[model samples]
Target: MSTELVSLDASKLAELIRTREVSPVEVVQAHLERIDAVDRRINAIVTVADDAIEAAKAAEAAVMAGRELGPLHGVPFTAKDAIDTAGVMTQRGSPIFKGRVPDTDATTVVRMKKAGGILLAKTNHPEFSFWIETDNLLSGRTLNPWNPDRTPGGSSGGESAAIAAGMSPIGLATDVAISIRGPAALTGVVGLKATHGRIPMTGIWPRVPRRFWHVGPIARSVRDVALAYSLLAGPDGADGFSTAPLQLDAGVGSSPGRPLRVGWLVDAFAPVDADVAATVRASAEALTSLGIAAEPVRIPVLEEINALELLWKLQVMETKPAFRKVTAGHEDKIFKHVQGVYDTPDTSIADFVDAEQKAEQLRDGFAAYFQRYDALICPVTTVPAHEHDAAEFDIDGQKVSSLHVMTATAPLSVTGLPGLSLRFGTSREGLPIGVQLVSPWMAESTILHLASLLEAVSPVRGLHPDMSRI
Candidate 1:
């Protein structure tokens, strides 16, 4: 198998398999080889299923027998450990539920398989999917494929790292705050956190019932993300709040003639690093190269965007009960990190109600903002991926806490807007920086259209870390 085959977009790969140019088994084997070669240094994959060979063989036989092929045909994809996979240990990065296995597949997983995506394995994540860095008592820490010392942002960090390292072209990941997009930025891959309720959140760990939680795809290209989105979207019936089938627009490469009305902003609730600012500026300049109307705009202070803190607090309120159920006889297995917040008091009903209303107001503010532009360009995180064990860092020469460090992404999460995070460039120290393009709620097509336009002018899909270990 050619190495170039591994880099083919999910669509192209599926077409090739459908045309019988490459068998499903061959494609799966190539990715499995890559994973075996590189996954150790990065530790991105948590568990590589032993029966992948049998599954791929079966897919190949179906194709050889002239059976109908799915959209993703022979493509291989991984899922974050937090996503429940039938018969696979869905350890949510915590030792408390170390050997926990699910008897049923998540709705998204079932859809992906039905669409012809082959599950390669499960990826790494932080304990309880809580931290920004991927680490836990079970799988250890997941390192950036580019620079092992730096982090691959979590809780989707492991998935990002694997794709960046060429272990998998696409992966299933979830987002509450910046888990999906943040890791995509840090690992130099394409990560999409679709508008809340756009994709069902069924069978995900640390499950939050609110609309703030979203599940989407992480891939090497925007088109791959779109393909995954199409396959994984729609109401699962179990998730009563999920939206109906989303109408996917033509892929980003569909139209290059029309210019995009791009809104550029850097000061998004927090400071942006010089490297990130340069990349965004250069990206906008590149958009202008493509006849795009790249306009500079100030981000409006959406009403009570800070209410994200409150929502996040409330989401974790269930953590105690959930953990208590798991750690019933063994509290010692629970990691002490972030215990202060969990052990603290719960939010009052009055405070929770006020926060929810404020969150709605923030969404309305973003609605007004999106009405003026096709999409808004912003930083995924204030800084590039930091050291693996970093607890805090200096921002603008002043020490800042980790929670405050990532305030830029919270507003979008609060508004439940669609955000597409693409790897833009590297920082001064050579760590990857992620820049995000956000659109109004349920406007994933617009978000992806702009991302594809940006990628065409300044291609980020081809950029990957040199994983010599592979």
Candidate 2:
């Protein structure tokens, strides 16, 4: 029964709870027990919230009283540690802030609670969310549930691992580059990097590249991702970028009232694995069965501006300084990957200004592409999850850097557009391979609608790792 309870997505769980077939307390307890049973093998969730049951009990009372319920009413959600939770430890997977706790919930967290979602726990992340993998001096390391020898991807890895392991149904994750989407792809789940600033980052850390930081949902199902996004995207008045008075509509089952065109590209930003490339192509062809125009696409600015390198250069200036300020005296407590941040060469004033200009060109390039196609499909990573701490990978006889994991994703971050990660294929090694669906800025509805359609045709839909092996 506990196994079945945890396997249910937030959407189905809420439906059951709302109908009184299940209670909020049962949902919360099932997750807590799942955590105790599975987290030891993966080290995904680092801090479990003590007040989770109390909050669930309150939600039950409201439901029994015949009061109004939100879409996610009585559901439980976990969050990446970088997101602040009032009174819950938000150490950011670093020993530098060993016992740090926040005084208020992040705008997203508060919104989730208002929607009747209970805060379940805090998941692991890389030190300050700066590295390519999720591990820290504080929480040890997080292993991929699909293959224990592989990584679950970094930054938002633990959030993905927890959901994939059936510990939590849906959770909050932020992306600076590929944090949210990359991890979700590696774990065979769904992740969304909403239009930059669509969701506020009021109580999150490492806001160095403020324009690149995006907060959204990671869930096991596409509908759960849509439900979370609908309940959370809005201006909270505290974040400067989130001040846009935009009303979001998730067009899941319905397409725009006109013909839809999509373009798929796999070899854009890096040398991708053959399997990964094939997945992107297959996803595009699947969209055609729905009467949409799907074809091969190439946006030149991707290689010319080189968003992956540009993002690294910009971060060397912004993220490095902020990291140094916090790790000043506790440098010894930091992980080697984070310590390497300081070793990065500083970006010169001229190059920094040039990267900023190139960012505009990248955005202009995508704007032109969208003029012809409603959405774009591409590989989320060059390959599936790599072996943990493995240095590099061989892609079609060429040696590729591990940094290529974020190459396909950093482009959207540069353009401040929306990207969704959903599993559409599996690797020869039986790991999940995901195709990214991207849309122009604030066109989240189009991407969601397309992802919903693709989800119906996904070859690996509803597949998960064998938890008994873990």
Candidate 3:
């Protein structure tokens, strides 16, 4: 019964709770028990909220009293460790902030609680949430649920692994490059990087290069992500970038009045695995069967955009100085990856200015492409979940730079566009393969609508890891 309850998506769980078919305490206990049973293998959860059961008891009382409930009433969810949670440990996967707990919840955490979602636990991440894999001195590492030897992808890998393993139904995650989407792709879940700043970044760490950072949801379904986005978006009076409102009532359905047009690209990023490319092509073909016009298109600007260079510049020029100031006296405690940021050559003001100008041009180029297509479909990464321990790997028998993992994602990050990653198929080794859906700046609804259409035809839907093996 606990396994069945944990397998249900957040929307279904909320429905059962609202109908009195299940109690809030039952839901919370089921997830907590699942975490205890499975988390030792993956190490995804860094801190389990001690007051979760008490909160669940209060929620049960509210339900028994027949009080009005929020959309996610009694549903349990987790947040990445980098996001502030009042009275809950948020170590940021770095020893420097060990045992740290915030006095107040992040704006997103407050909104999630307001919507009646119980905070069950905090998940792992790379130190300072700075790397693409979930490993740090603080919490060790978060392994892929599909294959214990492989990574779940990071910096939101722990949240992805937890959701994939059915320890949580939905979660809060942040993405500067591919933190949210990459991990979701590797773990066979739904990750939405809403239009940058659609969700507030008020309580997240490393507030530098604010333009590329995004707060979003990771769930098991498109509808669940859409629901969380509606609850978590909008200006919080603190994050200036979140001032613009989202079109909550826009066109978001599997069947629209007019057939949608989608552009598909497999080699947008170099050296894509043949299996990964095939899966993306299969997704595009599947969309055509749903009466959507799926065609091939290319944006040469994708080649022109240098994602790693921009990220390095942001790290050296903006994030490093600010982060160093905060961890001044405890330099030795910082993660080696983060400490390396300080050793990087300082970026000149002129170079930083030029990079910003190039980023604007890239955004404009994508905007112009969107004028011709309703949405763009591409691979989330070059390959499926790879084994940990190496910085570089081979793709299609060719040795490539390790940064290829974020190549396809970083361009969209720089543009501040909305990007969604959904499970479409699996690799030859049975690992999940995801395709990315990207739309113009504020057109998140378009991507969600298309994702819903694709989900209905996805071969990987309803397939989950066998947690008993863990």
Please give, for residues 124-241, the per-residue lDDT of candidate 1 as tens digits.
9888777788887777989988888888887899999989888888999988788899999888889998877878888887764346678899998888998898888888888876
What shift in Å separates residue 46 of candidate 1 from its native position after superposition?
Answer: 1.0
- Candidate 2: segments with Cα more than 4 A from true spot: 248-256
Lowest-scoring 10 consecutive residues by lDDT in candidate 2? 247-256
Q: Could you say which candidate leads in TM-score? A: 2
For residues 1-470, write the lDDT of model 3, one tens digit per residue.
79899999999999999999999999999999999999999999999999999999999999999999999999999999999999999888888889999999999999999999999999999988888889999899999999988899989999999999999999999999899999999999999998888899999887887878898999999999999998998999999999777655243344546667789997768789888889889999998887787999998778787866776676578787788887899977787768767778898998888888888888888978987888899989888999885578798689977778888898888888889999998988989999999987777888998898899888988999976665
| lDDT value, residue 72 of candidate 1 | 90
What residue runs in model 3 are displaced by over 4 Å at the alpha carbon?
Answer: 248-257
TM-score of 1: 0.93
**Which residue pairs overlap in candidate 2's backbone?**
none
Local lDDT at 338 for model 2: 75
RMSD of each: 2.6, 1.4, 1.5
Q: Model 2: how far is 17 from its true place, Å?
A: 0.4
Clashing pairs in 3: none
